[model samples]
Target: MPKPASASALFSGPFALATLSESDGPAFPALVRPDEKVLDLRVALGDPALTVRGLLEQWPTVLTRLHELASTERESGESYRPLAQFRVHAPVEPRQVFQSGANYRQHVIDLHVAHRAPGDERPEQERRAEAAEIMDRRAAQDLPYVFLGLPSSITGPYDDVTLPEWAQQPDWELELAAVIGRPACRVPVEEALEYVAGYTIANDLTDRATVFRRDMPQIGTDWLRSKNAPGFTPLGPWIVPSDSVGDLDDLQLNLKLNGEVMQDESTKDMIFGVARMVSYISQGARLLPGDLVLTGSPAGNGMHWGRLLRDGDVMDASITGLGAQRTRCVAEAR
Candidate 1:
């Protein structure tokens, strides 16, 4: 006979919750009061019956029950501990990380000027030609502009961002990252959202000098290097479930550089929205559970104004209801 489920079973490995108390070290279910730590539904509910593959297969039921339990505990005045006591990690190991580039109209224009010759035609004509070419390339490229990042590039919320000494122009890209929940191949644009697990914030850091080299091959390997620098992509804080963020098209996103608002825009402004990007990318590659796709960033990136990140800079990026991610920039230790 199969063993029945118990509260203890829920808190076992593969599913465990931890609390961050101001006065205590990290507290797990076995080490401290289950009620005292901040609720980590993914960690708090583990099932021996489910294999790693099966866990996501049964995620809906598991997540539903987990949320109910956590909410109930919170409603009862359980005196839950604070988040300051412990740090959070990436909730899942993403199989692949896909990022988009130059997807915003303003960003495209900015790049044209930055990359154009000093006297490359009249400014108005150059802008028009560049815009038209970008539009034309969109149809020809067909595929979404994607670059891969090493897992080492990813860091969790509240992590420090290391700026390499050679990084002359460090910039921040505030983007929405969607986590794939199911295996999908050649998914239609209309049905793409159904495969999503949730959304989180992503900072697509870039080094301008390396990316905008005029002598480098435009369509070759250098493009990838510029986009995939180490410690370039930072994600997390929480994976706001898809259901919780209804009408994905309407959400507002913002980025603050040291308490000053920088990028502020709505998802509605995206030239290629999430659904299309997902469906298009899937036609070329299969998306699996924990795989992440970063929808492109909006205008207002520091690169446009010749302002790059420096040591001691703080970046706080957030999406509506999804929570915020903050990172402090420090010089790469010599």
Candidate 2:
């Protein structure tokens, strides 16, 4: 079972929002329920520009209005539709994407152990201890590793993930993505949580084979070639308002590959939580509304299993309260 939020952390008015393109029309904002029913958010907000980014930019006021509407018109039978009725797009067309790497203690350890990299020359217990020590030092020193991702790689949660032939060892990384509401520049860690509008699920798909440049090993990892494939970042069934999501660190994340559980862990294991990641990123660059910060995935990726994603494979990623996303993988055209 998922952990509950504290009394102080509970949302005063609970609701989530999404973007969907219905009947081939332009995308519109929609209020989402955990049961998967949705309603036209524009009708509730009394606005026509049904864009999630617009709502996020004005979240301070819009959130209040959204709560009111969610209370009154929600139970009433008006404008609601089964989530399947609409063609879902990536919930937000984020202006920028910041993806975290090696943010999960167990995930990094799994990779180090599985690949037997230079650092793994020591015995199992010794290597694990060293890795844990490094993570502790990083947390104590207040540092995080973040990378840029192309917005063009974003795709719908339920969309098919097309794998390019160049990617031999394609993998899945189910992550919890933070959607920014307020612009932040060097925001303090204490005030950083307020900048979050909501949370969504992101499957940060990767190609394990290309992660390290064999030709230029000294140049280091190549996030672009390994992770920025078309539709590689499958995001959102909906963005549950951060307030409504309860305890940020206690949420559970699970990913299944064809009915088998591949990744199952709690956000409690995150070496860097949402607030820290946000505050750290803000110090280096300004974070604008609707920009995404993907907290890294937990352990048990395909790479750890020595079984990469295959053509026609299915991935179902779920984060407690935030909702679940299903993506089927297909080989790219030759």
Best by lDDT: 2
* CA-only RMSD, every prediction: 8.2, 4.7
Which ranges in model 2 have alpha carbons more than 4 Å from their true place?
1-14, 74-78, 118-123
- Give the best candidate by TM-score: 2
Quantify all predictions' global Cα lDDT against the true fold: 0.65, 0.84
Residue pairs with colliding backbones in model 1 are 15-43, 16-43, 16-44, 19-37, 19-38
Poorest 10 consecutive residues of model 2 by lDDT? Answer: 1-10
Please give the clash total of every predicted structure, in order: 5, 0
Candidate 2 per-residue lDDT over residues 1-334, each given as its tens digit: 1111221122223557778877779889887654456778776666776689998999898887777765554544365667667776788999999999999989988886666675446787877777778888988887889999999999988788899988999999999999999999999899999999988889999999999999998999999999999999999877888877778888888998988999999999999999999999999999999999999999999978878898889887788777677888889889
TM-score of each: 0.79, 0.91
**Global lDDT of model 2:** 0.84
The window of 10 residues in a row where model 1 has the poorest summed lDDT is 1-10
